[model samples]
Target: STTAMAGSGLFRLPAALNPMDWLAQPDKPGISPEPSYQRPQGGIEARAFGNVVHLLVESMANAIARGEEPDVTQWHPRAHALLRAEGIAPGDLPHQTQQVVRALENMLMDPEGRWLLAPHTAAASESALEDETGRHVRTDRTFFASDAPLASGEGTLWIVDFKSSENSGSDVAAFLAAQKKLYAPKMLEYAQTKRAQLGAETPIILALYFPLLPALVYWQAE
Candidate 1:
């Protein structure tokens, strides 16, 4: 199988993406930033905002994997620093800090969010894996969960990518459907690369986690 070739490091997905361009903006047509939580200073660039969120989540994931509890209360100062580093003006730091911190807290407090981020064997954040074509595939998060299997006997390998978009449309179903359509290809690629590394028989699950909307959208990969 191609996956087996990839596992041997002989086959990999082509290297087409730059590390800096890994994030995708959710502000596509018909989708907009959540109005209620919009930044007071207009708003930061979508990519910049996403970078900050991804960094924080990465930090939290590593901490969890290391058996350290994340202290949400202490996140404000960290958020301020991250936003400032992202070129956010100092004056808008307070509002943006709160926004980012609150989102993190919500993820920890929410059941689905916590489960997606929960510690598992070999859990890693911003994991960079090589495919058969010498392409580097960077995944937002990947973990092994023996307890959560997609089938009766198979252990589950999870690939979760984070999105910073918030859903504002009245039709929640349609909004999520659009998001899945927009991102499934990339997620599928991540799954394929992983399936090769882990073997074809292992069940791999692909997920897009939206911290802003506090939602988990996942499906099993064939």
Candidate 2:
């Protein structure tokens, strides 16, 4: 197995043999239809916004796993500390902090979102996984179940990648269509990596959670 061969230290795979390399080729056709609207790549402010959201979500998930209610009020101070630690300027901290809170609140209000954030027997935030060959992928969040079927009744693993885009005032279906095209390959790589690590029989489900837009976009492996 690839994971078995990938012992220690970093090893590079040839571009031709890498699935992610193939997906990154500009000429490659996408599996999903094009989106009606194009999402702009995030700027520094946007990246900082996403970082803050991630920190807040991780803190909340950790609290939930410990059987405690997450205190939303604590997020601001935490965000400030994290930003400073990351060398991010405090100029837009107030605006971005509020955005993070709003997004978290929006996610908790939705049924699917609530379930996604709920405590699990085993859960990881910003988890890193690497194959034996040194190919690595970092997942935003992962949930593990022993016996029961996860969402979509496909497998025991549930993986989520969060998007902080404000893709509003547009058709949700159209936005999702574009998102699938943009995210499918990476998500597929994540699933494939997990499958390789866990074994072939373990089913996996990958979902894109857009907290700002408050949408959950799911894709099943073919």
List lDDT for all candidates, in order. Answer: 0.64, 0.62
Which tens-of-lDDT digit does each residue in 76-181 have in candidate 2?
Answer: 6777776566556678666766777888887767666767777653566666666545664567877753222223321246778888877665677777767878
- Residues 32-100, candidate 1, lDDT per residue (tens digit)? 333212222224656556777778887787677678889777788888887887788778778778778
Give Cα distance to truth, residue 76, candidate 2, Å. Answer: 2.7
Give lDDT for model 1: 0.64
Q: Which residue segments of model 1 deviate by more than 4 Å?
A: 1-44, 146-154
By lDDT, who's the top model here?
1
The runs of at least 3 residues in candidate 2 whose Cα sits more than 4 Å from the true structure, single-residue gaps closed, are: 1-41, 84-91, 145-155
RMSD in angstroms between candidate 1 and the native structure over all alpha carbons: 11.4
Listed per candidate, the RMSD to the true structure in angstroms reads 11.4, 12.9
Model 2 / residue 31 / CA error / Å: 32
Residue 147, candidate 2: C-alpha displacement in angstroms: 12
Residue-pair clash count for candidate 1: 4
Model 1, position 171: C-alpha lDDT score: 68
